[model samples]
Target: MKKYLVVLVSMLGSLSMMGQTNTWVNDPAHSRLGFVVKHLTISEISGRFADFSVKVTTSKPDYLDAQIEVTAKIASMDTGVEMRDNHLRSADFFDAEKYPTLTFKSTSVEKTGKDKGKLHGNLTFHGITKPVVVDVVYFGTVTNPMNNATTAGFQIKGVVKRSDFDLGPKFPEAVISNDVQIIADVEFSPNK
Candidate 1:
């Protein structure tokens, strides 16, 4: 009976250890936050967050049990044009005052296909938090010579109205769109 008990205990311990997971850190050198905004009535402008991180972990290879957290610095906003960038950081747009960080935390992972999934998470910005769903496309992994890291890429895209976050409606005379599309092209490196 004692030998049987020992075997049972060992089996349970192995299962517990099996639950341990692996993670991948953001390779800042290869990762970036790129976005676009509408201007006037016919033009579109591009910008990016120079600094950000995507912290991810999982026990499965398909990233089925994976979880992710993202944080971007508001002050890193850049639109190529210096003056326009400064104004965006001011009280009119992002108001770099009351809100300084843009964050996202995943709630669940749903498989759409063999290489794709849907991530439903909460996005917090401009002092407002909303449930945002991102269509996630996994671009596989590769060994990078420039950074000497195994990087996995993802194209996380979604649309949310600026007004929903209390960013205010367009000026009575200003020409801009209400809905904002965000493309978070991010990469991650392995961690354990």
Candidate 2:
């Protein structure tokens, strides 16, 4: 009976570990990684990375202790103008050839309300990493009719200084604003 009790305890431990977290894949079709920056200290230039991936791990329905990671391809930036987009990918800016991807990993999630929270994370870009805090809004969840998978939506907004990442020096602050505004609309579906 002692041996059987030990076996049962091991099984229960395994089950608890397996159920500790749920994995969710970002749905690219319904997600966007976008940013806006001021140009010539006047008009604003907006762009987005066409390719990005995100994974959300959570143990609770409220997402109070959730963790998130994201990767974005620098070569996929689109600013509508071909020349400007190419310039952004060159050594003058992001240098997509050397640093192919920008990444973010969350450290903490603080829930403020039923659908609002503050997400603190480390954002890595242009070979530098810095802590950033962003406002997050949860849009609840739904079951997809096509695949019968549970999906959740979220919107995140934050601002980061380009100079903090050592990304740009070719243009002065007057020519190009140092601040970059980030906005992301993300949809995640549970992994099968």
Candidate 3:
């Protein structure tokens, strides 16, 4: 009976230490929200937003039951050249002044393969909210040496029609494709 009691106590102690599913904060230094798009139908141009935030709450190491919210500042666009970045922020494209932020909210997390799944979320861009399914591939986790925080994130891929959200009307006359690819990588550390 004593041995059984010790086993039960140990089990409860283990569970008690696990306050909740891996609650992580966004580690901006090691995380980024990047995007790709066809530039003039000649090549793919990649850009990243320097300002963003994310909060993740799911950690089976291979799965997530997370509610993620990302807010990207329009002025943080970087596309290798200052002129192009300014244009992208203008009314011809993102219209950074009027719509200063883009957002995403996860609705459900579905498990799929050995270490991948689909995160269905409502993505709001240019004031149009649409249900977007992002192919989420988990990249595992590690302890940050600098902060001593456990960190993890996933690569999310999705496509959105630029016209659907009234993003860029001028692009229709040029080689700018209607479909734009959005890729996001989120790295979160513990809220503590």
- Candidate that scores best on lDDT: 2
| Tens digits of lDDT, candidate 3, 1-192 | 999999999999888765557666687887788888786778888899999888766645455667777788989989889999999999888889988988888898898887688889888867789888878888887887887877776788888777888877866625777777888877877787
**Pairwise lDDT winner, candidates 1 and 2:** 2
**TM-score (C-alpha) between model 2 and the true structure:** 0.88
Q: Candidate 1's C-alpha lDDT?
A: 0.82
Tens-digit lDDT string for candidate 1 (151-188): 78888877777777766444422466666778877778
| Local distance difference test scores for all models | 0.82, 0.92, 0.80
The candidates, ranked best first by TM-score, are 2, 3, 1
Error of 3 at 117 (Å): 0.6
1-192 in candidate 2: lDDT tens per residue?
Answer: 999999999999987966588888899999999999999887999999999999988877788778899999999999999999999899898999999999999999998887999999999978889999999999989997887888899999999999998877878889889999999999899877
Off by over 4 Å in 3: 1-7, 16-22, 59-63
Pairs that collide, model 1: none
Error of 2 at 74 (Å): 0.7
Query: Which TM-score value belongs to model 1?
Result: 0.83
52: Cα error in model 3, Å: 0.6
Clashing pairs in 2: none
Model 1 deviation from native, Cα RMSD in Å: 5.0
lDDT of 3 at 31: 79
